[model samples]
Target: MAEQGPHFLMVGGVPRDWRDKRTVAEAVFNDPLPFLDVESAHTHEVLSSAMAAELVDLGEGIIDVASVRGRNRLLTRAIAGAHYSGVIEI
Candidate 1:
């Protein structure tokens, strides 16, 4: 038998109003351990332990990409643009 993997329930929403230009998305997993697994270092940015803790305290890991700084900000902007353009849903 093949090994089974954790399952994730992903939900995403965009506000009816575009004033804030923000999207809310969540990934709920059956197992918490798999949530921290990164398939590739080049494709993923590892958050510091402190940062992860902070996110857990603040909105349960949901981030306001507009308020993010540095390289992540750029990545978020691209994703947001793609979402708005209908290239991607979430």
Candidate 2:
């Protein structure tokens, strides 16, 4: 079974374990990353620990990309033009 989310996705886990099932929601926003919620009757192909790690790695990459993009944008703007910050005298 494959779980897809905003973060890393994996294709293995113990699916539909009643012991781990929940009524409302298994994990809250503060729970953590790589929340393994297998679908009913589905069998996971990956281990829980591995899935969590993969997800964390994915999230980290996304953050790194954002940081790099921000720096690149600032550099591009600096080279493209300038701004007048001080007030002009009448």
Q: Which candidate has the top score in lDDT?
A: 1
Kindly report which residue pairs in candidate 2 clash with one another.
12-45, 12-46, 13-44, 13-45
lDDT of 1 by residue, 7-34 (tens): 4322454335742555476578875432
| C-alpha RMSD in Å of predicted model 1 compared with the true structure | 19.6
**lDDT, model 1:** 0.40
The 10 consecutive residues of candidate 1 with the worst lDDT sum are 34-43
What tens-digit string does per-residue lDDT give for candidate 2 at 1-90? 566666553456435663356456564586443432233122122222323454354342222233324555543232122212211111
What TM-score does structure 2 among the candidates reach?
A: 0.15
Counting clashing residue pairs in each candidate, in order, gives 0, 4
Score every model by TM-score.
Answer: 0.22, 0.15
Instruction: For model 2, give the RMSD to the true fold.
Output: 21.7
